[model samples]
Target: MDITVYRPGELTAADRAAWAHVQSQAVAMGSPQLGNPFLSPGFTFAVAHHHRGVRVAVVREEGEPVAFFPFQRSAAGVGRAIGLGLSDCQGLVHRPGFQWDARELLRACGLAVWEFDHLVEGQKPFEEGATGTYASPVMDVEHGYEAYLGHLRSHSPKFVRTTLAKERKLGRDVGEVRYVHDERDVGALRTLMGWKSAQYRRTGRSDRFARPWIVDLVEHLFHTREESFSGLLSVLYAGDRPIAAHFGMRTPAVLACWFPAYDPQFSKYSPGLVLHLRMAEGAAADGVAHLDLGRGHKEYKESLKTRDLTVSEGWVTRPHPVALGHRARRAPVRALRNAVTAHPVLREPADRFLKRVGRLRAGAR
Candidate 1:
């Protein structure tokens, strides 16, 4: 086997075709997460336009491409999953049964240390490197929208009933309520971004839109239209105004939820949840088999998810002083976070503390 690394933009047409083939073959692996839109070459190329650090490692067997590993490398030789914080799905897209040494792959890319959260499970080479694993909720919509509604009625009847009631109330109090799954209007996308940015600030989290590159990347994705991967903006409108919106990516098989927010004025109606339900229904109608909610803990996720998928978080490092130093600095913090996230007892208090800090920050702003 031969390994070569190239900038995402540098990959030739043939190379990209091969990458897509490997990613498509991943569907046969039986895990819908393996077919995540974020893992597609189109997403990698979209991100590369705004991020110069992005690179792809192509592994070839007997001169035939067999695997593609996408990552972002810093000048200091540290690496991370392609889009890192913004990308919910992370892994090397490889042919089934093919394997390689994670350390060797890192060396081939000139990376001393590689860190990832939200690593899709069943990644053999990186499996042993995982320090922790978490459940990523998903809505199986292959059986169609009606079946999905049936699932909600069975598992979370009250949630579905109340959400529908609120939807009706919103229409009555405001205006006609409607949903558009693939909204092409750029203004709607910007509205979603603005709402999400304010939400991050209110929650005491770093605003992703504050970074010029991420903003640019999102804008680029909004316009990207492709079969293997495409950006989807779903909107729930009250008459002519968009009350709730979501910006996510979708392949034919999977719709990966990314950013979701709603007009605060309509918070009482839980429009965000309504938007998700609409997205699931719309996605199913579009031939998508699943809606990956990504790896996170939230009441909404628990209420809507039909099942869970495992995602791992950890570092894969080559033997080096820099690698050891990086581990020493990050391990403890990661461990503490994992502990808190694993237990509701700790997580609830941590969430409350963050909210308190958020209140202070919002006041100062």
Candidate 2:
């Protein structure tokens, strides 16, 4: 086997085709997450446009590409899965039974340590590197949106009725409801970022939209359209006003829920839920088989998820002084965060503290 590293844009037509072939083979591995849109080359291409640090490792067997690994290298030689925080599925998209040493792979990329928070489970090379695993919720909608609604009606009947009724009520009270599964309005995108940023600060979490690179990346992707991967902007509008929206990525078979927000003033109308229900309807109609809500827990995720996938979080480090130094710098904070997230009792208190801090920050501002 041979390995070569290059920027995402450096890939030739053959390289892209080989990458897609390998990714398609991944679906036979038999899990929805393995087929996530984030793992596709189109995503890497968009990120490469905004981030020079992005790199891809093409692993070949007998001169044929068998796998692809995309990551970002920081100045200190520490690496992270490309679009770590923003990407829900992370792994070396490869053919089944492919063998490679994680350490060797890192060395070839000149990375001392490779960190991943949403590593797809069953990735053998990094199996021993995981510090923990978490559930990633998903909704299998291959059977169509109505079938899913039937499941919801049998389970969370109230949730389905309330959301549907809210959609009707919102339409009647405000104006005719309009939904665009692929909205191209730039203003709607900015509104989503603003709402997401304010929500992050109000909840005492770091606002990702505050980072210019992330903003640029999203903007770049929003304009990108491809068969394997494309940016999807779903918006719910009342008359001429946007009320709820979601910006995510979708492959022909899967859609990833990334940033979703709604007008707080319409919170009583449950526009967020209405938007998601519409999203599912749109996805099913488009032949999208699954919707990945991503790794982590939330009431909405629990209420809507039909299944779960295991995603790992940890770092794979090659034995070196730089690796040790990086580990020492990050381990404590990572461990504390993992502990809090793993324990609901602790997480609740931590959440409350963060919200209080957020309130103080808002007051100061």
Candidate 3:
């Protein structure tokens, strides 16, 4: 086996094709993180544009590509999965049953430590890393929206009942209910961004829309489509006006939920929740079994989750003084995080503080 690293903007068509081939093999691969145009070249471009030390590692056997890893080195020599905050999954992509040692990969990249937060569970490279329990609620949408709703009512009666009632009230009071499963309207994407930016500000969080690359990347994804993974924009309308919208990606088997927003005017109707229920129905019909609600402990997540999986954020360090020092500094922080996350009361304050800090930083920028 031979390993080669390519700088961002240096990936040839062959490289992109090989990467896409590997991505298609991964069962959990979603559009925004892997298949979507924005997440593909866009992520690499963002890292390169910002001088964030992006690189791709290809492991080839007999001149045939076997694995690929996308990473970015920080100023301190720490290598992290590219688009860490924005991407839902992070790790090497390899052929099934083909194994590449994580230690070897890190050494080849000259990284002191390799870190990830949203590694898809069962990706062997991250098996030994410290992990924590997280859940992404999904609704089986194969049998259609109505059937899925019936299942929801059976599984989470109170939540389904309340949400349906709210949805009805919303339509009766505001406008007639309508749903567009695969809306091609670009204007709706802009509306979602506007709503999302406001939601971020109101909740004391950073508005990702401020970043031109992030905004442009999302728009690019909205327009681009692929067979293995495709961008999906779902909208709920009340009297011909879009009240809730979701922008996500779908693979053959999974719908990876990303940005979701709704009109504040329809907040009382819980349009966002209504949009998700509809998304689930659409996903199931499309042969998608999982709706990745993503990592976080929100009220809706709790209500919708059927099972929980574990993910992690930790690093394996090289035998270097700088790496050791980095680990030492991060240990206490990680411990504190674990402790707080284990306790709801402690976690809320920390979440609030982080959100406030994010907002302050965004405002300053």
Candidate 4:
């Protein structure tokens, strides 16, 4: 295999075409991460606009590209899956049957250690290094919106009744309720960001939009329109007033749920839940087979999801002094977090601590 590396923006049209070809082939497989829209070449392009560290490794055989590995390399020779903390799924886009060792590939990319948290299952090369597997909730909507509701109704009847009743009440109390599955309004997008930022601060989580690069990346993606991957902004309105909105990415077949927020004034009506229900309907209408809710546990996800997809959290490293040192530094932190998440008894206190910290932060602000 001949390996060539380039910054995303540096890729020639031919390189992009090759990358897209490999990306398309991978989507043919049933795995969610392999088909994740975030892994598309277009994502790399958008990310590169703000993050200069964005890089792609194109593996070619006889001058024909067969695989595309996107990643971020740090100054210390450590590497991370492209959009590591942000992307719900991560992996190399490769043609079926293409074979290579993960360590050799890491060496080719000049990375001492490569870290990933949402690696797709059955990634043979990285499986041995996986510390744990996580279940990412997904709402399989291939059977259409009503079918999805049927699943929800069967599994969580009260949840469905409550949300739908709230939806009806919202329509009755507010002006005519409206749904925009693929909203093009920039103003609504900005509103979503503001709401999301406020939500993060209130919840004691770092606000991603506070970072200029993330803001730029989202804007770049919003303007990027492609069949394989494109930013999708969905909004719910009540008589010309936006109540809830979401900004995510989607392939022709899969929807990757990203940022979602609602006007806190309408919190009582659960407009965010309404937005997702409509999103599933809209996605199904667009022929998307699944809506990947990403990796995490939330009451809403549990109530709405039809099934779960397994992903891995861990690092892959080649033997090197720097790699060993890096591992030594990260192991304990990773161990602690894993332990906390695995046990509910510990998780409750951890959550409470975070909430208290959030309260302090809000008070300070």
Residues 1-365, candidate 2: write the lDDT tens digits.
58999987789988998887778777766644567888999888888888769999999888989889999998889998888778898989888778789999999999999999899877878867888889999887899999988888988999898888988999999999999999999889999999889999999999999999899989988988877788999999998799999999998778999999988888989898899988999999999998999988788998888888889988899988888998798789989988898799999999999999999999998
Q: Write the per-residue lDDT of candidate 4 for residues 58-78, one digit (tens) a residue.
A: 998988888889999988889
Lowest summed lDDT across 10 adjacent residues in model 4 is found at 24-33
Judged by lDDT, which candidate is best?
1
* Tens-digit lDDT track of model 3 for 203-270: 77678898987787677667667665567899999999999999976766667788999998778888
Of candidates 3 and 1, the better by TM-score: 1
TM-score of each: 0.97, 0.95, 0.85, 0.96
lDDT of 1 by residue, 1-365 (tens): 59999987789998988887787787867655668989999899988888779999999998999999999998889898989888889999888888799889999999999999989988868878889888999999999999999999998899999999999999999999999999999999999999999888777778899898888888899998986889999999998899999999998899999999999988999999988999998999999999999898999999889999998998899889888888899999999988898899999988888778888998887
Which stretches in model 4 have alpha-carbon errors above 4 Å? 29-32
The positional error of residue 245 in candidate 4, measured at the CA in angstroms, is 1.0
User: What ranking emerges by TM-score with the best candidate at the front?
Assistant: 1, 4, 2, 3
Per-model C-alpha lDDT, please?
Answer: 0.90, 0.89, 0.74, 0.87
TM-score-superior candidate, 1 or 4: 1
Work out candidate 3's RMSD over C-alphas. Answer: 4.0
In terms of lDDT, model 4 sits at 0.87
Model 2 misplaced regions, further than 4 Å:
28-31
Model 2 backbone overlap count = 0
lDDT: the better of candidates 3 and 4:
4
- Candidate 3 residues lying further than 4 Å off, grouped into runs, are 28-51, 131-133, 142-147, 349-365
